[model samples]
Target: MNGQMELVSARTVKGPDPVPDLAAVDRLVISNSGGKDSIAAMDEAVNLADEAGVRDRIVVLHIDLGRTPGGQSVEWPGTADLARRQAAYYGLPFEVRRLGKWPSLFHRIRARGQFPHLMTRFCTSEKRAAAHRFITEQVNALGVSGRPARIVHVMGFRAQESRARARRPALEVDHRASSGRRTVTQWYPVLRWSEAEVWQRIRDRGLPYHWAYDAGMSRLSCSLCVLASVPDLTCAAGLRPELAREYADLEEEMGVPFRRELSMAEVIRRAGDGA
Candidate 1:
């Protein structure tokens, strides 16, 4: 399904030739997910800001999903740490935020009696909302200080990643209002970048990426995301048998499978088929 990009008008003061002043922008927030695309996106954002002479206004933000019931991260190990290190490498401020206690994917599943499926991707909703909340708070704080708080939110979504993403515009004025004194805009710096270009950028910087990519995983988000490809699911299940078992148990308890066709146990079994 293709997602339509939302259209919103930029707020401007009335004048003979009223134009939104880009120089009045206060912050550029980059959503860093510790994935290859996110890393590339950050690099592109920094480069663009540098060209526009606004590099100093850039900040990197990451959201921690917290640990599961078994005290393990739902994301790949060291994902957050990698993001912090990358921020340091880029000489930018880094902030980590979460939705407070019980923020784990498993907690949500237990509460809903089901996992996040393709149709109802509660996981993405929760995480995205948390990031938005953080941005809103920052805007409000700047407003209280009587500053022009214009935020440019940079995301790593690429057009080539999916049909839905391909429909997104390179830039859009966010519909949601922040503080009255603040304006928020969304930008996709690398919206049209290819996967090869993404990896090339990472290598050009000599950066160490998340280990999951090295382990042959294509996309990096939730370790057992419902949108995971068969190979990704198999590899995740193989690498983290304990986590796979936990998911399997949850599936049994809910009397519903996370994947449409295969169970977690079946995915694991297939993972070891060739070996």
Candidate 2:
């Protein structure tokens, strides 16, 4: 990630500027998660590309987190559906990718006999590795076709999301680089966008977002992410009691709780207590 990192102020760029060298870009892959931020990022990316007369080069990629036990998805229902619909709405090509069999987060937790920690996040690492692998494969395919690929990998991270994210640069060279003839660059078009601005952009585009947000979910990465807040976990349990039970059952079987201080059973109990 080499470059003179610039922390663009949110107040300065309500909307992102177009890429300076659109003609030199081979592909502009937008990572879509079917979330508000992702939708807004894609909208901005499309606008930028369209203004530069390179809209055809835009592509959207969605990573599907496999199902949990009892054949239930770990991700929010209709996430992929909305992503595909959004892609079609914008007339951009879309692709969905997933890890191989036994890719379920629950399966990993059971196998490891431990849940992911906030500090040691294996779940996020695994998912990120898979996404990077897919991106690398795409770059390689372009190289095989004798095309010099210069990829602009776009994400939906916003500075207002968190302090850690607020420190992120607007642009930088990604650590993962394709060999000769392939260059990888990272772009956070919505890095300076506020939460309200993100939603405003989605509403302005009249795009249908994932239903999870309406159901009170602040983030849509995982149905029961370790980083989820008390309210988020409670909401998830209410929506999917069986999946929540699976967590408690696993915790009992392994004699290890999902959280260090609280067991899944206790967490659910507290949620029921409305505390």
Give lDDT tens digits, candidate 1, residues 1-275: 10111222243221221222334457788999899889888887786567668778788999888777788788888989999998888899999988644668788888888778778988888877787888887776665464446777888888887788888766666656454565677777678878998899899988668998888899998788788888999888888777888888888989988777878878878777832
The global Cα lDDT (0 to 1) of model 1 is 0.76
Regions of candidate 2 where Cα sits further than 4 Å from its true position: 1-20, 144-148
Candidate 1 Cα deviation (angstroms), residue 178: 4.3
Q: Please provide TM-scores, in order, for all candidate models, with all chains considered together.
A: 0.87, 0.87
Model 2 sits at a Cα RMSD from the real structure of 3.7
In model 1, state the lDDT of residue 59: 82
